[model samples]
Target chain A: MAYRSTPLRIDRDHALRERILECALSRVADGGFAALTMQALAEDVGIATGSLYRHFRSKGELAADVFASASQREVDALGAALRGPGDPAQRLAAGVHQFAARAWHSRRLAFALIAEPVDPEVDEQRLLYREAYAELFSELLEEGRKAGVFQLHSPSLIAACLVGAIAEALVGPLSPPARAAREAGYPAPALDDVSQGLVLFCLRAVGVKELV
Target chain B: MAYRSTPLRIDRDHALRERILECALSRVADGGFAALTMQALAEDVGIATGSLYRHFRSKGELAADVFASASQREVDALGAALRGPGDPAQRLAAGVHQFAARAWHSRRLAFALIAEPVDPEVDEQRLLYREAYAELFSELLEEGRKAGVFQLHSPSLIAACLVGAIAEALVGPLSPPARAAREAGYPAPALDDVSQGLVLFCLRAVGVKELV
Candidate 1:
């Protein structure tokens, strides 16, 4: 019973940190990263701004922590798509489709984080974030190559392109218009068709034939 | 004589605007956009801050004007690439390679512009900027398609991905160590190789069996 007290105290600290992060997210979502300030976050969390330093050493550290958390959620989504039952082509398409849908929905937050460097300190986490997406595409390409379902010169290079391209799909010319069109009396498709076409283009670049 | 006087005055005004922009670029190159202020720019250009407003309505206006001018250099670059003689494949590679190099070299200013939306009035220019890049890419792809060099669902979509990927390539990851690895002795290939691969991937995506 006494040993249980240690875990409970740790949980309390965790809970408080989570509360601050949640408030930060709401602010960041409403306004871009330009609005995220430690003072504002602390006020929202009902703590002295000094209390924030105990959890995060600096504003960059706090932003990094929050970004890491957001990135992990992104990684988890890719993992689900990767783990879901399907063939290499099917899995890849489904994975990209699901990601595009979700990312397009979170465009404001994603654009703020991806377009600008938050903290140069969290760069590794960003790579981890990229690596997670890379792995999903890599495994699909590798599996397809092994099974003779795909022909590729370099699985790794192609995987990198897919990861980069698919992520780009959620932001650029297509995304902004897609968003506007979605809101302006157009029915939202279950998947982003243009994004799907881009993914298929990569698959075909690897010589995957007969893939829709 | 009176008609000539108005034209000369307009030309002088244009020249002054150009001088201010040139000074702004030099200052931004030395520091970064975040450090650029109306006051500092006024001093740097030998004009009083109040006089500066005669050329640019506000700091936001100045930045937008500066960006509009800098972005024109890219447009000129695009025109130069188009005017030179090459097949669709060669032109496509040349265009992307130059874009990558330009992006890598002017990364500081480019990062500032691409990573943030300007004040609302200027923000509309961002869409037009992206469209220009898209149109440039579309021109190459269309040339390729016309010559039976490229085939795809949409040449426009592929071009956006290529341009977007190139921009994303210039940005550092959220992790500082990885960026250090890139600068230090990492085995990663130079960005030139990535640029080459990107163009090659695009050709392959469009059903080109071999690059010309």
Candidate 2:
């Protein structure tokens, strides 16, 4: 009976861990990584601070976990868009458009994930997730090249450029200062304009046949 | 006599501070930021660790200063290349090639500056320097667009994309693991190839015609 109960206890621990991650992710989505204090997260999780420590050793460790989970979601979303139904160029445009729209909607979280100054651990995750994004773009780029829809010798290098271009393009408009400036009625590019400019820049860079 | 002595003491302190920063930059360039420690840096300067703290309150502060100084040199160099004698397209290509070549020659330092996971203070500096780079590109992009040599609606946004693309493209090739893989006989993109591909990409993206 004790042995059987051990399985149930492990299940309970796993469920509790999942709950903690969900709460932590929400905190980051709302206020960037700065708001993800272990003490506050413990209160949100309805667990003691000591219990939180039991699950994650340090704030850096916990933040890295949170960063990975959030970034993975983004990677998955981007993957779906890139692999969706269309020609290579169309898919690329759709993916870039979807990515920009999503980031525009969640400006704070997107800024946090893309360019926020945070723990080194999160920065490590940034590099990993960037590689993941590049891989997805690599697949589409190679396909585009083979289909004669794109003209590029090195797909991998160009994919990395796309990842960087997209991130850098969104970072400015989504940043807090930019958002504040917009709130104060300062002129700023709208989401459509940014998305279109990025699509054009990427499509042109890849040597697409014609620009629509 | 006291007043006169004060100026001498101030001069000595300033000279010592400059020496400390130069030593710190060398340490970072040689081994990335991981090799930068207060004790080791003090030893390199032939001073006590306590004296090092008198100049820099913390490792992060020292690291950030080194980062800013090193990055400023790159920015200045790229600026000279971009603002040099050429048409918009020629200048852009020249700047890209020069930037890539400089980074290739100093892979480790370039990697550290571009993508190493380090202190938040340094990360903050990264954002600032990236802005500096983007601003430089903005000037050129706007010039190109006005000259009808490049076609782009938003100079600033496209400038950010170019900055991101250049940094991202180099980050992969310049990363430590990639370096090790190349050293171990794995195939890697040559600097010339990268420079040519990057120049072509930038030129095409900006609507530069008749690629020579």
Q: Write model 1 residue lDDT over B67-182, tens digit each, in one string.
A: 77777788789767754678877777777678767766765666555543234333445545766877787777888888887776667777666655555444432123434677
Model 1 chain B — which ten-residue stretch has the worst lDDT? B170-179
Return the DockQ of model 1.
0.19
Given candidate 1, what's the lDDT at residue A161? 69
TM-score, prediction 1 = 0.68
Predicted candidate 2 versus true structure: per-residue lDDT over A34-89, tens digit per residue: 89999999999998999998889899889999989988988999999999998999
| Residue pair clashes in candidate 1 | A122-B174, A122-B175, A123-B174, A123-B175, A124-B175
Tens digits of per-residue lDDT for model 2, B126-212: 999999999999999999889999988999999999999999999999999999999999998899999999999999888778774
User: Can you tell me the CAPRI class of model 2?
Assistant: high
Error of 1 at A89 (Å): 4.4
